[model samples]
Target: MKARIHITLKNGVLDPQGKAVAHALESLGYAGINDVRQGKYIEIDLAKNDADTTRETVERMCRDLLANTVIENFTVEVG
Candidate 1:
């Protein structure tokens, strides 16, 4: 089984890097550029045989080592 995980900053979190990128784009004369935010992604392969079990394990991984729940959120997809 294969799993894909996305970890991103929670709403209302300050994104200084994103703000800098936006300013740089404006300096380059880009039009209508609004804003940007940065996030994280993780992919894993599981030897477990069931989707339910795989999701459970990966969720645990996200909580333990993959994402910082203090200011971030994570989602998991299994295939």
Candidate 2:
């Protein structure tokens, strides 16, 4: 099984890096670049075969280490 995870900052959290990217885009004449948000993408290969169990394990990983639950939210895709 393979697990794909996406981690992103929660709403209302300040994202300095995102802001910097937005500013750079504007400087490059990329007009109408109103905003930007940055996030993380991770792909994991697992030996487990059960889809339900793999999803549970991935969710646990996100809650424990993959994501900062307080400031970030994570979504998981299992295949």
Candidate 3:
């Protein structure tokens, strides 16, 4: 099985990195940029073929190590 996880900061959290990127974009003449948020994309390969099991395992991984549950949210996709 293949799993993809996208981890991103939750709203209302201060994202300095995202802010920096937005500022850089404006400096580079990219206009109309209101905001920017940075995130992490993770791909994992698993021996299990079941989609439900893969998603559950990946969700645990995200909750345990992949993402900070206090400040970040994650979406998991399995194939």
Candidate 4:
């Protein structure tokens, strides 16, 4: 089982890095920009095919080490 985890800041959290990028884009003549947020995508390869168990394990992994639950959220997908 291959797992893809996307970690991102929750809504209402300030993203300074994303803001900087957006600003740079605007300076480069880009228009109509609404919003931006920085995030991470992690891909994991597993040896199993069960999504339920993988989801649980991935959630635990995120909570324990990969992502900080207080300021971020994660979505786990299998491939």
- Model 1 earns a TM-score of 0.90
- Answer with 1 or 4, whichever has the higher TM-score: 4
Ranked by TM-score, the better of candidates 1 and 3 is 3
Give candidate 1's total backbone clashes. 0
Error of 3 at 22 (Å): 0.5
lDDT per residue for candidate 2 within 16-67, as digits (tens), equals 9999999999999899887899999999999999999999999999998889
Q: Which candidate model has the greater TM-score, 1 or 2?
A: 2
Compared with the true structure, what per-residue lDDT tens digits does model 4 show for residues 18-74?
A: 999999999999999999899999998877789888878888899999998888999
**Model 1, C-alpha of 24: deviation from truth (Å):** 2.5
Q: Rank the candidates by TM-score, best first.
A: 3, 2, 4, 1
Better of 3 and 4 by TM-score: 3
lDDT winner among the candidates? 3
CA lDDT, every model vs. true structure = 0.92, 0.95, 0.96, 0.91
RMSD after CA superposition, every candidate? 1.2, 0.6, 0.6, 1.1
lDDT of 2 at 74: 96
Candidate 2, residue 15: the lDDT equals 94
For residues 1-79, could you state the per-residue lDDT of candidate 3 as single tens digits?
A: 9999999999999999999999999999999998899999999999998999999999999998999999999999999
Candidate 2, superposed: residue stretches over 4 Å from native: none
TM agreement with the true structure for every prediction:
0.90, 0.96, 0.97, 0.91
lDDT of 1: 0.92
